[model samples]
Target: MTETLLILGAGQAGAQAVLSLRQQGFAGRLMLIGGEPFLPYQRPPLSKAFLSGALPRERLLIKPENFYRQADVECILDIPAVSLDTAERRLTLADDRQLPFDQLLLATGGRPRQLQCPGADHPRLHYLRTLGDVERLREHFLPGARLIVIGAGYIGLEVAAVAVKHGLKVQVLEAAPRVLARVTGAEVSDFFARVHAEAGVEIHCDTGVVGIDGGADTARVHTAAGDVMEADVVLAGIGLLPNVELAEAAGVACENGILVDDLARSSVPGILAAGDCSNHPSAIYGRRLRLESVQNAIEQAKTAAATMAGKHRPYTQVPWFWSDQYDLKLQTAGILQGHDRALVRGDPRSRSFAVFYLHENRLLAVDAINRPAEFIAARTLIPAGGRLDPARLTDESVAPQQFA
Candidate 1:
């Protein structure tokens, strides 16, 4: 008798696990399932190059169709899993087909958080989470079009930047006091707000959306201040809600996300979770984290594959993320929260600099804007608890590696 492994949600993590399992010499009956019809694809570019018409649809695929065939992996696409029975180790699909597995991996990821206000269901309102969403939204990215963007997070700002490049009149409405407020420090947020403003992008911080009303041709956005703004299309980039209903329904432990150990094992036996759907303990940060980045999905899936392969590698690598806007590349390493002091290494006015976060002389993280060297150095220094003189850190004369 041969063992069988079933992977749920054919996204970044699922695709990576399939490759890693083969590399680990798993030699089992491998199967991948996804709700989307397309093969597992790269999502980061959907809002950047793909939306800008720079990258084609074929380039978005993680692996070509032949790869799955040659690897002898069965891919079940376009159908969603309906239920999970942990006791019997069976998964029921939407078509009423039930499959049994020896081990299961949940990489169900997440979906865009939708607007709950009235008229949010308007046909012109859009949310960018899937490739189909981008394709539909791209049709309305015309020149001189009035676009209203809700939320000032990464997805919101990235879409706004792309919209501006396409000659669209873009207006970003963020309920928070500043753009990127929830993710970065005050100085970083202010810097981004200034950048967007200088690029002809109208930004409204501290403004909230109340409701939406529209006709067949256009839509009207009602703000909390009783101001009504009309737009050809509206996009909401609020945030994401994890896809944990199947796991929750199966009696799996879940908080902010599915609670998992460093090995990617959930509370239930013979089952594991990864990517945006799972919350695992991070020894480096001394806390649990639910990260929604490409790096996290790839690396953590490798860990989960290793565990399933009877390996002993723990998922303790330092977390890093990056964002591309206009001509700027913002790279971050480690968690910036709980820092006592933040130091700027280069001049922000020059549009190139790095901010270092420290707690009691220990390096916590680094936010590097157009500074690749500083970003690379922080990746190693942060995890090693590297210490540096505050005065020297602020001086650009010293190189980042010198601090290490």
Candidate 2:
């Protein structure tokens, strides 16, 4: 009799894990559990294309029903695992049914960071992280709806783009000195600030939002800077905290995320974790990072699946991410943190193209706007294990691929 390999959470990580497991010839019985009712879907488009009414909702699914059936993977959608027994290697569902597993993969991703200010519980205040959330916001996506978005992060900005396009009076409030402070440089942030401002979207940088003032049909957003912005809807895109409750409860060694080895294995034997809920110490960047990119989900999932199938190879893939807003397509590869010096290229005024970020000499990170070739070339600069000359980088005549 084949023992089951139970995979918790059917998001990108779990869905990719199942596919990778099958590809690696894991003949064990598969059980995939998820809190979401629908099939595994890509979340990036939710705030951009789906919100903008450019892409249909159905197209976001990772796989159709037929794929799961063909792979012999049993899916328990819309159900969350209530608890897990470490000694028995078993899982307890909401209904108290016990599921014995030979091995387990935890892809229980992160949840949206909620605000604690006044009127935070109001019905008009929205946080877009799931498909259902987008559906609800779609109703208010029409023209003339005053939309106030807090946080100038990717989600907030993407949502603002869609709202502004629909003729909504959009106002974005960022406590940071500029937009996207954590991800990119001051140049990128200032560029987006100009673009959004030119689009007639009101942006308040270096401003702190105190609370959301709730009313009968709308809310007044109060900022620490003394600006009271009125809106029909308020969207919060603060950040996410990992859903590591189950792992921590089961006595698994946890840190910023579930402490996992390079193979994506948890501290416990026969247990593994991936996706946004995992933090693995990497040899590439020589640091620990919990990546939230789709690429990480797919590649780390492959690591877990391959490891489960008895392939003991370390996961060593370069991290990459992409974001699309209006006409700008920003692609980035490698982690950019703690870089001493940064080089900026391209003209943000025209919004044409540019690749800018830090590197001691190696290309630690590259933010390419409308430049796919540079994005691809920068990927090699990191792992190539050589310091790229800063002078050659800034020279307009030199191509990024010439780093070779």
Candidate 3:
């Protein structure tokens, strides 16, 4: 009997797994299941180009519809896997169909963390997590509309930038003291705050939305400061929660996310997890991390595929991510945890600089603002674990090559 491999979630990780398996000479029965009706597509562009109407719907697809058929990968779209039975090696779909498999990969991804306050269910309140969500929100982006964005993170800031370009009055409310506080340092946060402010985005840092009021035509955001700001549309961009319920229900280990090894293997034999849903140990960072970036998802899927094909390759690529807001591009590499100091090279005022996070002369991470060359060079230096002189790193006269 030919062995059957079942993949859940059909997002970037699931689709990549199918491709990687074929490339690695795994000719077994391949099946991918996704909750969304459409084929696997890119999510990053939904907030920027796609939301701005600059990118068409067809461009969002990762592969043409025929690619799945050509690859001989069976795709079951618009239905979700309701439950998983690791003991029986069976998965129960929403329609009560049980599918058995020799091996399984969970790439369920994540869902947006919704606002819990009262009136959050109002018709005008919006959250962007899927293509459908963005399409619905796009209709409200008329010129001169009032957009009240809740959260100072990438999604909120990106949406604000897009709204500003469309001639909308934007107000961003961040619960934290500064923008991008959770991911970036104070210097980087302040720099982004200035950039967004200069783009006509009203950023209210240290402000929390207590509740929302009103209906379809408008919304009034009640803040922790006893102030109410009305909006034509309100967007909640707090963050995401990993889709690990299936893994947890199957008795698989889960901590914050589905616990997986370097090879994306779960505690249960023949079961693996990847993408935003899995939290795996990082050989570079020496800790368990659940990254939501497309880079992490694709790399982890390849690792899972290789391991399932009996190659046992580990996922050790240095993690990297990027964000676009207005005319600025922010690129980040490596995990910035445990960094004691940061060195800035170039002028933040000019909007072209790189901030290097170091620990006792060792590079840990790099955040480059509109400096792709420096970002690319820092990616290599980080994984190389090479020591650098702080003075030379910060010196504007020195090029990035000198550090090598």
State residue 10's C-alpha deviation in candidate 2, in Å.
0.5
Candidate 3 achieves a global lDDT of 0.92
- How much does candidate 2 score in TM-score? 0.97
lDDT by residue (132-215, candidate 3, tens digit) is 999889989999999999999999999999999999999999999999888888889999899889889999998998998876
Query: In candidate 2, which residue pairs get closer than 3 Å at backbone N, Cα or C atoms, i.e. clash?
Result: none
Candidate 2 local distance difference test against the native: 0.86
Query: Which candidate do you rate higher for TM-score, 2 or 3?
Result: 3
In angstroms, how far off is 32's CA in candidate 2? 0.6
C-alpha lDDT score of every prediction, in listed order: 0.92, 0.86, 0.92
By summed lDDT, which 10 consecutive residues of candidate 2 come out lowest?
352-361
